[model samples]
Target: MSPTDILRLLLKNWKLLLAVPLALGGSLFYFTRHEAKSYASETTIYTGIASGYSLTGNSESDYFRTSNAFDNLLSLIKSRETKEQAACYLLASHLQLKELDATQLSWASLSRMRALLPAALRRQLTGPTLAATQRNVTAYASANDTNELYRLLNSHDPVYSVEALGKVNATRINSSDLIKLELETEDAAICRATLALTTQVFLAEYRSLRMSQTAAVIRYYEVESEKALKRLNDAEEKFLVFNRDNNIINYYEQTKYIAGEREYLYSDINKIEMQYAGALASLAAVDKKLAGRGASLLSSAELLRQRKHLESLNTEIANQQLFARQQETDAAPRTQQLQVQAAETVLAIRTTLNDHYAQLNSVEGIPSKGLLDEWVKNMLEATENKAKLEVMGRRKGEFMAEYHKMAPLGAMLKRIEREIDLTQKTYFALFTSLNDSKASQQNNELTTNLKIVAPPFLPSQDKGGKRLMLVAGGAFGGFFFVAATLLGMGLLDKSLRMPAVAQAQTGLPVLGLLPAHPTHPFKKTKKPAQASKLRDHSYEHAAAEHLARQVLRRVSAVPARPFVAGVLSPLRQEGKTTVVQSLAHSCNAGGLPTLALYPEGTDAGPANDYTRYYSPAQATLHRWNLAELTQPRAADVQLVLIEFPALLEATYPVTLFPELSLVLLTLKASRSWKPTDQQAVADLRAATAAPVEIVLCGVARYDSTDLIIPIEKSKTA
Candidate 1:
């Protein structure tokens, strides 16, 4: 429909609209009457996640770690375990409040019991102080949130407490650490008190758990450090003892000493060999001359060895001298030291060789006794050389064995030193770790990083602006509710309420709108025949005259002559018979010779159902057989008003019509005609070529008396 059409409809329902809003106002007042005033408060807290943590690690981190840190904190806040603890604390507070309130209630109940006692007895039982205290406690409970406290404390189920915990809302703002937590309740004090206590419990638990974990780690590190220190000490002691047993300082220098000893032993053997050889030569000469006066003794192996050592030392000294001369003082210190040692060795070996040569040269030609002495001396010297050679050989073997041990002893010593070094490094590392752990533990012991930058305060305004919003919303809601009820009802209703509504529903032109006749409120409506027994009132008479003119005009517009219009409806009690009787009276009175006929075998019976009536020229009423209705009409009748039983309810064959014009008489201002009944009207139109118009009865009255006409008062009792 166009907006104009909607506006017109609303205009027509203006009075109903007014009535609807008033009804809504009354309903709102009732609903809001006993409701508690609500309050709300919010708190902001930075969870330190968005700010980033002061953790000991690489300072720069991934965005996921930075961003999702608050998400972890939010989980902590909303955790079921945390909420459970909050519930316990809140429940305890509720119990305490309930206890205090219960005392007052108990006193009040006692006072009431005392009041029922005799007056003198009541005076004896009651005390002024007790009564005043009771009144004050009761007032305190009433003014505070003690009613909810009482209920909570009295409840047997723990589920109530669990459900109560749901009141807290922990909201993260835009996935950041900025959290807005709120508690909503009828009482502001309860909200504030509960949030404060719960926050304390949560902080204490969270901090304690974190610190405890750090402490455990610190203890573990301390144990490890102690173990490492012990291993370091053991390794160091093992290395020291090993070196003492070997009679060594450093393995490298000890090896050099063993080599020097071997060289010296060989040099001594050479010297002894040189001296012994000289003696052996002298003995051989004596032995050869004994027949030529000669002695027969041999030189020792030691003398031969000494002679070779002396030559080697001399050669080594010469080589060192040549090297020293080339580089001079610029020679390496180690090389210079080697040159000096070689020179000393050369001097010792040369002196020993000269003494041995002198000993051999000093042996003179001997007399018999002197020669014998020389022989004995030569043998003795040879024997001494032999003993010295044996001793030198044994000493060289021992020195050689010691030299062979150098690598194994040095390896063992180096291994112990390495173990000591590694242990010490480990111990130091563990110590550093222990210190770091202690620092971390201390840091953890500090307050939790979550800081409530802004704590919640007692709310100044009621939550949600609920009262004003509800009132305004109720007004808004009432408007739509009223619209739906009125408009929806209007659309769903197929009954004729106005001539326009009747025409719109059936697509039939409305002939007239007739006002309802007044009647006693408690009296049931009489049957049509009984109703027709009474003379028509002035309103009915005027309505009949006004409607008849429209009907005749409508008939004139149609191609069919002398319209034989039947007053019909889909169902009974739609005033079809009444319209037929009235229209017949009006037309006949207006000098149109009209006959009104009720169809045969219908609920409309014979004369027994009719009241005797006469107009100056009334429409003849009949209940004719079907065959007679099909016969030729009488010459005097100019118009015919036929009445039928409800067409859809009864089986009226469509072919029964004989050139009939149909007037569908639908009741106005009633919800009587269903959409299903309109099809019956369509069926009637399909069956007959004559124009079908509708008469809408009992419309709402509007005074415009200019078009009304007087009707003849022709009724007789």
Candidate 2:
């Protein structure tokens, strides 16, 4: 359907569209009449989640972190625990009230609470002051989940419940750190009080939560720091014990001194060997001068004993110098004693050798005194050198042994030092982390910046109810809904509601349209004059006259004696009888002798001069011969309009097709064309060579006007 068709349909049902919306809107207004006026309270808070100064210094804002922070803040504000606490506080304040105070609660709300709370329970819970009442309420609420205070907070009551407090809305103002909180309730005092309490509770809870988080982190870092410190101390203690047990002080330095002393001792031994060799050679030459006497003197017991004693003292001093611990290096007295004993032994040996030489006489008996003196000095030098060589050799062996022992000690010491170094680094790292955590905790404390910029105030004026807006919305909504429903029905409808629609559906040219009229053309009425006036000026009469003229023009080409036009329909009640009667009247008025024939049961009231009902039995016997059926009126009739039974219900009389000049298919404008109707029309066309034109009856006035306009214009032209 076109938009024009839809517009026409809606306009035709304008009264229904108006009535439905008005009725729906009226009902809505009446039902919402008792809606109470609302009171609103708003508070603004400075929540520094995105841009805030802290002990940690200002940092660049992170979109994700700031978003998360705001999310957390909003979640905290809406949290059940926070609201419950606020509700508890509000309830405690109310409980402490001795009488209804406008500042605290409205009279109706106070009265409602009194009625809800038993007098005995109320007295038990109430206290002289707000603080005492809060304590009492807390204690009572904690006693059980089924307590009155608990139940009240959990219930859906509009004043003291957590659910009620959920109405408080917290939103960040644009991208700023400020938050706007709003709430509306039936009572102004309740609205203001709820918002105020909720803000306080949310701030306290947020601060506590932030502090707790930082505190937990600080505690963890502190624990790790303590562990790190203990590890460091343990490493140091191990090192200390290792040093004590190993008898070491500055192990590297002690080893270096030992190595230097060992090298010096080896060099001294080399020098002493050179001296002993030279002295021995000299002694040998002197001995050659004193031959057997020198040999006997060197073999003397005292001399041998002195030399052995000197070697023993030197060995002891060398051992002390080469192998003594660093702590033992302070034994200077003992070292000096050992060196003195060695020197004294060397002197005794020299004296004994001198005495032996002095008492000796040259075997050759030539300058014996000088020879003997030289021999004694050389003998003492050789003896002392030999003793030093022996001590130095032993010290070299001890030095090598000490060095080998210190190798493992060096590795162990390095391992211990490495442990201490690692532990020390760990300690410092944990200590730094602990300090950072402490700083963060301090920053959190400083940045708990929930400041109320605009505190909630009691609303004085009542915010009017939304009754008018709701009523208007309902009316508009109902109007749209009804319009949409009608449009959907129209789109889905397949009714041939217009002459164009009938022509399109049946693929037949429309002769004309017959507008729906209240007055039946065949029915006799008490007031004939009024009926005549109705038929004369009515659109239906004009449409019928036009349709009859079109049919006459088509049948004028037929060579039959009396032009027979068959009025047929797909189904009964398609106004086939009406069309036939109207066509006959139109023809008779136009000076054409017209005869109208219908089925036996048709309501063609008492046979008139131009109208008659035909017998089905005779028509069937005569094979629907128009001449045979209308033989009696054939002489007076120039145009015969025969109304056939619905073709879908009864078979078409193919015998009558040869006698008919034209066939008018009368289709109701409000009825859909079915497949059977199309098939019946096809069959009727095959049975006759006459032109089968469409006559749309019961058409809406607008559709009828559309069809009549062209005709009227053509006639005028």
Candidate 3:
């Protein structure tokens, strides 16, 4: 459907459009007429969530954290517990008042409260003071869920219920640390009292929660710090015990000293070994110089005894020197004494050797004294070096043993020290955290900065009612509802209500349109002449004549005589008989010989000279042949208009299609076109070669103006 059609449809249902909205809007206005006047009160508080100072010092505000904090504040304000406590306080304050107190409640509110609360119950709950009454109320409310006090708090009472207090609106003011709270109620005192009590209760709860959180953190840190300290002490104690048990007093330094002494002892041993080797070689050469006579002379007991004593003296001196060196003490005195004794012994040995070899000749013909002296000195030096080497080797072995023993101690000590260092670090870190938590706890206590900047006050004027807005909203809501319903119906409607729609639905050309006139063209009347005159001047008559002229023009195109045109409909009661009768009468009046044939059982009105009825079975069997079914008509008849039964109600006369020159598919403009109608029209077109056209019958006058000439205009022409 086009936009114009939609506009036309809405205009056509203008009465309904006006009626529905007015009814709904008026109903809303009437219902809200007795709505109580609302009084609103607001309070402003400094939340200090974004830029607050505390004991911990000021810091840059984080956008996300600040937003979350504000969200938490708002949520707390609306929390059930907070609202319930506030409601309890307000209720208690109201209950304690024996008479009207303007500061606490209005006259109207006091009366209502008295009506809600029985005298006996009110006395049972009330106390001497507001605080006492509040305590009593809290205790009574905690008794059970079904208790009167608890029920009052949970009920929908405007002053005492948690639900009523939930109306308190809390919001952050821009990006600042300020928050605004608002509430509306039937009474000014109730609005102010409710907002004030809610703010107080929420702030107290928020502070308590923050303080508890910080305390919990502090406690956790303290516990962890204690554990860390215990671990550190254990590590230190283990280190001390390990040191005491292992006899380790500076193990690294002791091992270092042992290593140095061992290196020195090895050097000394190596020097002594070289000296012993040189001495032995020199002694052998000296012995060779003292030939066979020298050996016999040296065999004397005195010489042997002196030589053995000198060797003993040298060995004793070397022993003293080695001992003194290892002990890290002065060995010069002992070494000198032993050296003197060894020198005396060497002189004596020399005297004996000289006496023994006085007349012995040397192997190279040299004197025997020099060779004997050289042998004696080499023999003593070799003996001393050998003894020194033995002593140094023993010392080196002791030093190596000490070094090996200290090696494992170094690793054990390192491990203990590492453990101690790690434990100490952990303990210190936890201690620092504990201190920070304490500081934060203190900061939290100091920064409970929710201060009411604008306390709520008793409202002097009542807030405006929403009656007008609700009425307007209802009216607009009803209007749109009706429009949407109409739009949906129009979109879903399949009725061919217009000539263009009929042509589209049927897939056939619309030859003409017929307006729905009150005067039935085929109805019988007592005064036939007057009925005919009335029908002649009707718009339906005029439209039918126009349709008949168009059909005759098309029929004239065919060269066949007695052109047969069948008028068919998809269903009964679609004005097919009227279309057929009007077409025949118009054609006959226009000087064209026309014959109209309708079904035998159909109500086609009294037969006339141009109209006749035929049996449906005969028509179907004989293929609608005029001579076979109807009485013989005038030979000059140029057109035969046959009105067939509804296609959906009876079988279509397919055999009659060969004889027809044209088929007019008549459809009711006010009725929907179904798939059955399209199927019937499709079968008819497929069965015959004749042209099929649509005549949209029973159209409103406004819809048919474009297709048919008006009766006035036709008469003037």
What's every prediction's RMSD, in angstroms? 12.6, 4.3, 7.9
Ranking of predictions according to TM-score: 2, 3, 1
> lDDT tens string, model 3, 590-683?
8888888888877767777677887787667767555675467867888999888888898655677777888888888989877887798888
RMSD of 3: 7.9
Better of 2 and 3 by TM-score: 2
Model 2 misplacement above 4 A: 138-151, 227-231, 293-377, 397-408, 521-538, 555-561, 634-636, 651-653, 710-717
lDDT of each: 0.59, 0.82, 0.82
> lDDT per residue, candidate 2, 119-180, as tens digits?
89889988888888878877887789998888988899988888998899989999999999
Could you estimate the TM-score for every candidate?
0.53, 0.87, 0.68
Better of 1 and 2 by TM-score: 2
Q: How many backbone clashes does candidate 1 have?
A: 22
Model 1: residue 82 alpha-carbon error in angstroms? 6.4
